[model samples]
Target: MTLFRQIYALLFVLFLLIVASIAYVQFTETQSFLSKQMESDINNASHSLGLMLVPALEAGDDVATETLVNVLFEGGYYQQITLTWLVDGKQQVWTNDIRVTGVPQWFIDLNLFKPITKENVITSGWLQLAKLEITAHPGFGYHEMWRIISNIIIVFSILFLIAILFARVGLGMILKPLNSLSEHAQKIAKRQFGPDMPTPKTTELKELVRAFNSMSAQLKQVFSSLDEEVSALRKKNLVDHVSNLPNRQYMVSRINGWLSEPSSGALMLIKMDWLEDVHSQYGYQIRDETIKLLAEQLHQQLDEISPSVIARIAAYEFAVLIEESERDLLTRYLQCLIRTTNKEISKAGCKPNERFNIGIAERLGQMTVTDILAQADNALQRSRQDNKVFHWFENSQQQLFSREDWRVKLTEAINDKQFQFRWQPVMQLENTEVSQRELFCQLSIQDNMLHAGQFMPFVEMLSLGAMLDRCLIETVAKHNLFERNLEPIAINLTFQSISDQDFHVWLKQFLQNHSTPERVCFEIPEASVYSDLLSCEKICHIIRECGAKFGIDHFGRQFGSMTYLQNLRPSYVKLDQSFAFIEENQHNSELCRALVNVAKGLDIEVIVTGIQEQEQLARFSELRLDAYQGFIAPPEEIKLG
Candidate 1:
């Protein structure tokens, strides 16, 4: 038991001892005193009665003797009274039956009275009264003693109950520190520490709590630091540096994490694309400040029970993972975040008009982690088309998902030569049908056809996206002799696709080993550009120094400022689908005009993408677009032996 309980028990033992002592002492003294008083009263009554009767009996007045007997009996304090006269010096006794009167026979036996003491003096006629003896009524002391004892017991019982009541009330306060310590220990077991937990007050327990809290602090410090570095690695392709929220890359990473889960929870991926100017102007510092404030605001708005991870996956893109949280409440939470962040955006030099694209998904039963991530990623990608967050349906999970399946098929394809090299037919109008076309990626899984859209995006998110990408590139390079190709072949590089410090050095070494450096084209997604210009530029410079070509795919999607465009010096700028569709409104289309003009000024050729319709194809041709790719021209899968 606890110390308090032990103390309480000790006090209870002490109470019992005190009560027993008091009861014993009171009973003993009261019994002695009552016995003495009763004895004295009995003696007085016998003496008085004897004195009163002697005079009347000596006078030979029969009527007076009868009257004295009556008075002795009637005015008696004793239970029974009687008078007897000695004849011829013979002793005699007279008394009414005490048992027959109010006294019990058993009580009489229990308090059995011996012959009473007497002191006799001469009356007017001495009748030898000195020879008198008396006996008390049967139950005289029994009833009186029981009443005294019972009263003493009743009083002590009351005192005992009151003391127990007081003990319970006072015990809690005395044991407060112990209770606090118990709660603290429970929290420590769960690895949770914060201000919400109670702190103990007593010296010993307080010291324990302080020690425990310090340990927790150290653990958090270590783990949080580790998590931050992993976060930095995560940010290599996808993070808002200031808020540390996952950017597009982080969104893809979250999808990766979800896809990896045996049972994926709720996925709510939010894209904040309004902070481009903020990053471009203030150099990501203010953009980061804005995202940080927004993250705090968003976290405050989220469900207290809903666990979430926010990362800046791209410079202007933030992805939020709301795991197993309620949908409607999550919507409200997202709305709250949008309102709060946008409200503060202006003060942080980010606009109030910053838009958020949200994607919501839940894993279907019996699906691989990869498929779920694909579903979430596709949902996010599609949601980017709309301003509101979009919930996923069955179609959101594309056909032929999962890396293991893909890897297996890819290996078989690599062996069986099922892999086909398709040219995206990047035709410069100035040079039609040139022996060169930008090499587009195609995965022919026997009968099921998969494109980069099918699995590459999801693979880019996995820890080994870079590995898979490199493996694909190496396989293609190993099999294909790019040394003698007429058109330069473009190989895609993800922001994280090759962030391995060792891998970059390896790639530079590989460039020297295989294909001629001039024949290689390194294509990076413009939309997924790194936030750290210095790091990105340094990498780009390294790739350029390899004497290879560099181009940007999905260039206009980010709608970044022209300043970054000047820095990249890409060989090709792939126009976004929307830009390709809206080519007619040149004067009104500030976005497309800005992109095309900036690319022209930087000597970067523009490639309009997704031009499947004749109208779009016709329009882009009229606008002097550098190249075109889409269904308008039949796409023939290229076969490389």
Candidate 2:
């Protein structure tokens, strides 16, 4: 019950008790006063009649005496009047009026009230000649008594109402601060509030708000540190050891997670056109330096507009995922990644005179992470083979995915099971060794292995993205674990999945019936959580109760204030390829140093996924990473590149 209701109930009960007591008192007093007043009036009347009748009786005037008795009987407020004669010690009574009516016996017998009667005698001036008796109407007394009781009840009832109204309004005023405190607590829990307190009316409540804000500020700092630590761990987890670029595992993992939500921008996959040529002529160092420069330039350019992930998914392969626009951030950012590649090479002590050929591919969404990369790669491959600038996916790229077509496919896929899970190792980089593997999901048919890239557009067009996520989790849990050694596998779900109004209730039941989260990764992307931050917190709190680890798959892409990161402590961060690649080729450089220092202060374990060689291991070793995974530590896996 609410505070007001509890207080109102208590007060209302007390009011009932007081009103009942007052009614009883009023009834008793009314009965007593009425009885006394009636007796007095009757005694006065009898004395007057006695004095007058004495003369008439002494004169032996029976007519006058009888007439006096009759006149008394006719008087109102008297129920009965009687005259009695005493002969030699025996009394005879004559009554002209009787006052008795159908009054309830229960009412008459009740102690709170009683009927009244009076007696009077007509006697000579010296001695009594005759006695007179009168009684109050039983019904009249009860009616009057009831009227007094009713009036008291009505007056008390009005008072009770006024008290209730005053109590409600006054209590609300008194506890206003407490109510605000409750709201503040909720907002703080959702990571929406800062260290400010709500002003309160009461001193104690004000003090409580002040204290809460103080503790909230302290907790904010503590969580911020933990958040940074976790994010650092996430970034550390996604690097290439040799090249210091994110590996294929991190790229696919990060990209799909980003695209799972609706994006306002585009996703592009850029491949080095003459990567093979550089390897052959310039040797490994320059070639590696060239790749690292591309990553840094892209990251420097693309980060402000949309988050970009640079990953070396394959040998000579690199991909970028941007969440902004094809025109605003992507088009311009893409030019920097490819166009400025040679200019930055000078800092790496490379020849500016060295001619470089590049193949780049990019696609505008709402495309999945891989398909965009594939098109970009396809464009790059075509550009390299045909010797042109970056080639976009041709054959009417925008028209290729009509809403009607994908909607049908999504509808059919949902009605029938089609998605499956692919396992990639999340290497706990201790002593430069791989420790564990986490599974990601992909939709599979007879031919194409559709990552979120190919099929999500269909799901989105059909407006069934949330349903697709459910299907994916269910499919992955059913198929992947039974067939492989998948542990702590996290399948990234779209924001829509978490924010569904009935999400928790439905998800709880789904897990109960379909799959438990022991080997399941209910991976929620950081961006997704950030978008619907409040709802995301609620969902995370609920989901975490199931003992599943809450992890943001791709981090370092969103340009968010660190405050939120401090509050939401995800399992780990998957670093952006830009930094990973910078660390890769630059080796012991300032940028990499800053990245490490910043990440450490946050207490996050660094995991590097893009390392392409043993020589690059020195860079991460100095970073004090908790774990690292990349080409150097790449384990044998068929599902991963």
Candidate 3:
């Protein structure tokens, strides 16, 4: 029981005992006084009656004596009265037997007031006439005692109720401080350091709250310092000091990470031929300033194209990675870059063509980082030899479908529902059990099956993500995936779907109709979340309201602030595939460890992806992740019933 309840109960019992004791004392004292009064009244009455009856006894008037005794008996105060003649030895007795009235039988049975009898000798001119005896009725005593006791009980009951009500209110006020302290402690457990609690009026509680607030402030500071240190380390190792862009190391890591997935993009290398000339003519300062200015212009132009990375790979060479395979879009962006760079060159008092050369390489089937880099370098050499402003690396491979053909194929697939579902299980490290299954869908066209990576870019490019997501949700629900198994199914949501209000409404209805909403988890990429945090947060709220779950995919890929994790607070986060290479470099290891600490501190589960080998799993095990997902085991293709 709560402390307030226990204290209240004890007080109530004590109050009852006190009232009972007072009632008992009052009852007994009233009974004693009534008994004494009854004895005195009976004695006086016996003497008065004996004297009054002397005339009748002297004249030997039996009728008058009987009348006087009968009158006294009818008064209801005396229980019995007797008068006897002593001279003749033939007793003349006037006896009256009466019952007590004006009181309950139970109260009379208590015998609180005992019956009082008195005897007296009657004298007439020095002659003993008769003896008189009178017994007092206990009815009046019982009636008077009952009234007094009843009044005492009624008054004490009122007082007892008032005392109990006041005691409960007072106890609640006194313990309010402890309740506040408990809530503060729970926040601390979640690593959420909110504002300090107000000090309580009680001295001990006030001190306790003050100490707790101090600890919370200290903890917040410690976490802030750790985050700052990690940020500084990342900047020093992966960022270019002059251009403030990602350095060569960071670019290479990102390229490898992208290549691990079935994705397509292009890489452009910009060679600044005039940097060396400027350095010799003016100074290193002016040359650095020119590079910085060029970097700023590039950022301004390419900032709109997301999933793109700009890096200063060499002292005089800069690289831009764009995750776009559409030739027209690529060409438009390239033209804009050329115009922007030429403008900067004129401002620096240099000829645009003589100042730089550009090389472009398109990502093709199953290409590695080295393959793309080599292709771009060959293109650069060709551009310089041809004395051209830019050159493109040609590939013999052709696309599987044209833009129109892809549109037609995807539309047909969606309409006809020609999609196959597959899932890979994420295993918990401690128990080696399936935590959840990451869902994947493939388009079955003719005799070929294409994975999401092969066609998802087109889906987003065509703005058909909302349609695709709706279809997938309906398919999954129709199959009753949750009822078939206990494990939750994690579905990756598109930026387009999450940003669409109609899609949100549809999702809400779908989840509501499903019997087990908890078994559905919607995941969004980290890049998409950072791109539109408010939209993502809204969708997450909707999902939670429907009793489903939300998670973040490729969690540590973006360079945005980690503060969003505190606000969104997803159920779990899947680390970017790049973290699988942690065993390759010290910087990678430290970055992974720091990211793990940040997420785990917030009570968020961290899962590492791309675990293809035992050694990778062993290395990540040191980080104490909740689960892992990769090719350690092949993905199982789920057949729909």
Candidate 4:
């Protein structure tokens, strides 16, 4: 229970005890006092009656004496009244017994009142004519006692209730500061700090809160320094010194990472045809300047889209990799990029013959890292031979639809609401509980169904990835998935979609409209975040503020630098499934341990994904992952119940 409730309960119990004791004392004392007072009053009445009846006894008037005794007995205070006279030295008695009624038998027995009897001499002058004995009933005392006790109980009850209400109000006010401090502490655990915490009136609590705030500020400053150092180190290693774009190594690593996910897009290789001539005529200095200028312009154009990884690969060549929602738009964008580059070159006073040849290739299916680079390079060779500005190479062996054809199919599927959702439980390995479930969405066209691998790349290339994300959000929201299950729902957002500003705004608003924003999580790939850490950081901050959680999907794929993690401290990170297969190996096990330790330090949960085998599950259990998802949990259909 909360401290406020505990204190309130203790106070209530104390109040009840005090009220009961007071009621008991009051009831006993008032009843006893009333009994004594009634005895005294009845004794006085009997003595007076004996004196008044002297005339009747002296005259030997039996009828007058009987009438006088009957009158006193009818007064109701006395249960019985008796008159006695001695005649010819023998005792004579007159008695009236009127049974007590209307009072409860239990009350009468509990109150135990003994009758009072008094004797008096009825005299004419100085001689005693007869002795009169009077008996007084105390039944009326029992009735008065019950009334007094009942009134005392009612009055005490009201006082007790008022005391309890005031006590609760007072306690609540006092504990308000403690509640604020507790929330502040929780936020600090999440690496979030408040503007200013309210100071408590209690001296000890006030001091504690002050200490906590001071410690929190120091920690944030320390983390800030760490983040700066990590970012500088990452930039130094990954970026080219001349062009200030990511180097060949970073680009290749990123392409490899993207290949692992179920998405596709295009890669453009731009070669400066005039660079060799410029270097021979104007020397290396001017050639370098021209290349730098060209690099700057290309960076400006490609940076507009998300997941845009630009790099300087060779002396006369630059690579720009982009994942778009529509490949058709990418072609238009590339054509525009080529035209703009030529204009900049002409403005730099280069001859009309000074031109650029570009190679574009589609990224799809299970292609190796070398295959993608080779195909783009081959396209560049073909472009140079054909004397064309650009050439396209289909990287995958499987024949595919043209960009326009796929676009129509995607639009029709969306219009027909042909998306199907499947749920697989993310099990909490420590216990057997399902802590979360991941949503897998597929496009259904007539009798054929296609997974994300087939269509996501098309959606991303066409810039329709944002639409796909929105469709998922709306479907999940409408179903109230969180309400149907005891766990949160995890949905994947492509790098292109998260990079889209419109999608970012819509997601924020959607979370705000829902009562349980925390019950929904957005899964972003590790490489996608690394591709654009600055933008990802800003996006994550906004979404987290709206109470939505972020998880790094496909973690450890880069395996080179985790510096981005310092900036984007997500709620959890899912270890890529490939690690699970090699978990029994000592090297992989140690690597997994290192990752878990790093995650634990940042207070981020670690979950292993794609647990398909019993041995994999057992091996991961030994590794102590926070959760696991995939076939080991066995796929189950979601039910509203």
Candidate 5:
């Protein structure tokens, strides 16, 4: 039982014992007092009546004697009265049966007041005329005793109830601090460090609350310190000091993540051949300033385009990866960046022609990081050889659909409800149990089965992400996937859907209709969360409120703070796929370990994706990961029920 209940119960029993003791004492004292008072009254009555009857006895008038005795007996106070004739040795008796009114038989049976008898001699001057005996009725004494005891009981009964109420309130007040401490501990368990608990009036509880607050503050500081350490490590290793852009290692990992997906993008490599000359002429400070300025300009220009990465790969070479599938827009952005770089270089006293040579390589089907880098390097060579500012790496392969064609295909797929979902099981490392299944949606268009990586970009580009997400949820519900598998299915939410308020409302209603909301898990990309934290937080709140789970996808891909995990508190986080190649990349391995630590400290599950080999799993195992999803357990088509 809770402390409050236990204390309350003990107090209740104590109160009951006190009331009983008081009642017992009152009953015994009242009974004794009534018995003594009855005895005194009877004795006084016997004496007075004997004196009054003396004259009648002296006159030898039996009628007068009988009349006096009858008067006393008929009064009902006396149970029996007798007049004895000493002269003639004869006796006359006047008696009445005892009867008590307005008292229970049980009280009478208790015999609280016993019958009292008193005797006196009737005297004429110096001699007694006749002996008089009177017995007092116990009925009156019994009635009086009952009345006093009943009143005491009634009064004390009410006092006991009032005392109980006061005790409950008092106990609640006394334990309030303990309750607050308990709640605070629960929050800490969830890795939420809230405000300090109020100090209580009780000395011991006051000390305890202070101690708890100190512990909570320390815990918060520890988590903050861990996050700071991770951030410092990231900056030290993955970030370039001169340009403040991502270093070469970071870019390679990011490009590898992109290449793993069945998507198309462009990598532009810029070689600053004149940077060496500038360093020799203008010193390190000017060269560093020039690089910083050029990096800032590049960031500003590329911010308007889709998500891209700008990195300082080498001392004189920088790379930019843009996810723009359109050739014309890519070319426009590249030209704009080149012009901006030329102006920065000219202002820094370098010839425009010697400033840089640009290489452009299109990210196409099944390309590795080396393949794309070598292609871009070849393009850079051609640009230097032809004396051109930029050159595109030539490819004979063509895209399956134009931008408009993709829009059309996505629209048709959504309208026709032709999106197919595959389930990839995520196994818990502890038990090898399927913790959840990550859902991957595919599009069926013109005899082609397109993976989510292929068409999702178009869905996002066309602003159909919300529509597609809604369709996918409905399909999952219709097929009763939750019932069939008896495990949660995590659905990936697009950035557009995460930001759409209407989609949030629809999702709330949909989950309300779906009885088993716990069977669904909504995953929002870490990139989306970085883009608009408020929107992501709102959606995450809604999802959790509806009894479903929320997780972060591509958790460590973005260069944002890990502190957001403390607020969003997702059920789990799938580390970006780039971390899957940790066996070959020690940088990724250390970064992954740091990310996992920060997340696990908050009690959030850490899941690594793209675990294709046992070695990758073995490497990640040291990090205490919860689960993983990749080709190790390939995605299976969820059969419709």
Candidate 6:
């Protein structure tokens, strides 16, 4: 029951008790008053009768006395009347018996009223004649008591009902505000800090509503500020510092991801053979200028084949991954890139030798990454030996997949529902108990499982990222992951999906009908979140309103403030895999430490991934990270419920 109903019920019971007590007291008082009045009347009547009968009795007229007594008795004013006379030293009496009527026996017994009996000595001319006694009938008193009780019951019953109706209206007015307050509180719990609270007449309730509105406003402002900081950080993390293209780490991940798919591709390595010579001739400033000019030219030349990954892998080497199936088209692009570099170098007044030497290797079917790199290096050495600007390793693979083939394959995979989800456990670092299972979405085409990193680039390019995300969400719900494992499950969302307005709307409705909303966590990429903070914030709010939690995935890679951490106040933040290279990557360790301190101050759980070795686990042991995931424990197959 609600608090309002409980209080109203108690008040109603007390009101009934009070009414009953008052009615009983009034009935008792009325009964006493009627009984006393009847007694007084009887005493006065007996005295008067004695005086009247004395004349007859003193003259020894027994018939006159008897007639007087019978007249009084038959008048129905007395139940019995008696006259006693002294005759020859003995008492003679005249008596009359009268039966009472018109009063209920039960009522008379209940009231217990009795008529008063009075005795008077009759005298004639100062001589005692006879004794006269009169007893008043209790019928009048009984009738009066019944009338009083019936009136009291009727009047009070009407009054009690009126009081109840008034109380109900009054209480409804008072407690109606409480119901609004309850709904507001529920919305707040759902992270929907919306409009101001309703105004109520009651002073205390009005103040409470005002305070809640104030709190919501303050929260919204704080998150707004946090979003700004995160957005700035995300742009900084994705771009290469010197070249303004994607950095080497991102390029490597992209290439490795592409190599995972069953398609023919190529990796081209461009070395600035004469960069050292240029530096020796011109100062470091001129060297930097040359590198920048070279980078701009490469971007311009490769703009047509836009979707390829290009990066400044090192101070002197630039890497590009081409997932094109046709060797002739790939070769043509490489030649064009070389010519653009040559022209840019000439424009910058550099020697022909300082222009560029490029080496390319075709992606052999199922070849290890190490073998491909070695082949590329061999090709680069051959190009430099022959004094040629570009060289390509022989394309030995017979089966080649063009860009169109991959696109069609991806579309078919999605249409046919050729997808699988694997569950990776995140265990508490301190207790070593599984706390949650993070979901990894994969595409399976022709029985070949492809990791998200392998196909997401294509999926995003084709605007299918949101579709993939929804598929994963449905899969989780269909499998009843939470019900079967009794552990929380988290699914990742890409930048494209998060920014898509349509996806957010669909997700909101989906979560509302989901069975285990509270057990589901939506993992938003930290970089993606900053791209459109306002939209992401609204989406996050909707997710929370549906009883789901949000977390920042791939944290600590960006060089920006962690102020957003305090503002968004997500359930947890998962540190990116780079943070695990404690010995080799000092900068990464420092960044991890800074993030950890900030997270600790904000009371957010810090989950570290890529824990493949015990040393890496021990490195983070003292940091008191909340959870650990990755190669430390291979992903287990999920059994559907």
The Cα local distance difference test for each model comes to 0.59, 0.59, 0.83, 0.74, 0.84, 0.72
- Best candidate according to lDDT: 5
Q: For model 3, how does the per-residue alpha-carbon lDDT over 518-631 read when each residue is reduced to its tens digit?
A: 999999989878889898988998898999998999988877667787678899999988777534677777878888888887889999998888988988767869999999
Given candidate 5, what's the lDDT at residue 232? 78
User: Model 1 residue 211 lDDT?
Assistant: 74
- Looking at candidate 1, the ten consecutive residues that score lowest on lDDT are 256-265
Give lDDT tens digits, candidate 5, residues 1-641.
98898999899898888878877887788778888888888877887787778778888988887887777777758888777788887988777876788999987787666678888887787775677778888987878887887788789878988998899888888888888888899999888998888888899888889999999999999999888878877888789999999998888878888888656679999998787888999898989988998889888877776568999999999999987366877878887888888888788777886757999999766688899999999999999999898999999888789889988878888878898878889998988889999888877778988787777767777899899999988888888887887789998888789999999999999988888899999988888888899998899898888899999988888886788898899999998987775345666567777888899898899898988878778887678888888889998986675
Q: How close to the true structure is residue 124 of candidate 3, measured as C-alpha lDDT? A: 79
Indicate which candidate wins on TM-score: 5
lDDT string for model 1 (1-641, tens) is 87778989999999999989988888678667766766787787667766776765566455775676556555543444434444434333445543334444555465434444444442454335324444555244556666676787899889889998889888887677677667766654444444533565566666776777787677546544443443333344334556755455434534543433222345555566667666777776666677687777766666453556666555555556664333355666566655666676667665564355666666544455356556667787777665444545444444355656656665555455444566555666666664235565666565766655554544443444556556666866876747545777777776665456666777778777764777777777654564455655666776788887777766644323435654656667776554554325534244455456556644568887666677767665545467776656655665566
TM-score of each: 0.41, 0.54, 0.87, 0.70, 0.89, 0.61
lDDT of candidate 6 over 1-641, digit per residue (tens): 88877987898899889878997888778778877887888777787778787667667776787787776667655777766665544454444454346566776676477557888877776677777767777777777777777887898789878987888888888888888888888766545566787789898888888888887787657555454444443345445666676666656545554554334558888898577667788878888877777777777778675336678877888888776335566767876786777776676567764547888998755665677778888898889888888788776655424557768987777666667778889999778999888887677666777776556655765677787787777776766776777778888886678888999999999988887788888888776665567777888888878999999987865445665554476888998765564344544444456567666556678999878778778877667689998778888876554
Q: Which runs in model 5 stand beyond 4 Å of their true positions?
A: 56-67, 74-111, 117-135, 161-176, 195-202, 262-264, 324-332, 394-409, 582-588
- Local lDDT at 559 for model 5: 83
Residue 404 lDDT (model 6): 74
Worst 10 residues of 3 by lDDT: 89-98
- What C-alpha lDDT, on a 0 to 100 scale, does residue 183 get in candidate 2? 79
- Give the poorly placed runs of model 6, Cα more than 4 Å off: 1-35, 45-400, 403-421, 440-456, 465-484, 488-522, 531-552, 556-573, 582-590, 593-605, 638-641
lDDT at 615 for candidate 6? 76
Ranking by TM-score: 5, 3, 4, 6, 2, 1
Flag the better candidate by lDDT, 4 or 5: 5
RMSD of candidate 5 to the truth, in angstroms, is: 3.2
What CA root-mean-square deviation does each model show from the true structure? 26.5, 11.5, 3.7, 7.4, 3.2, 7.7
TM-score of 4: 0.70
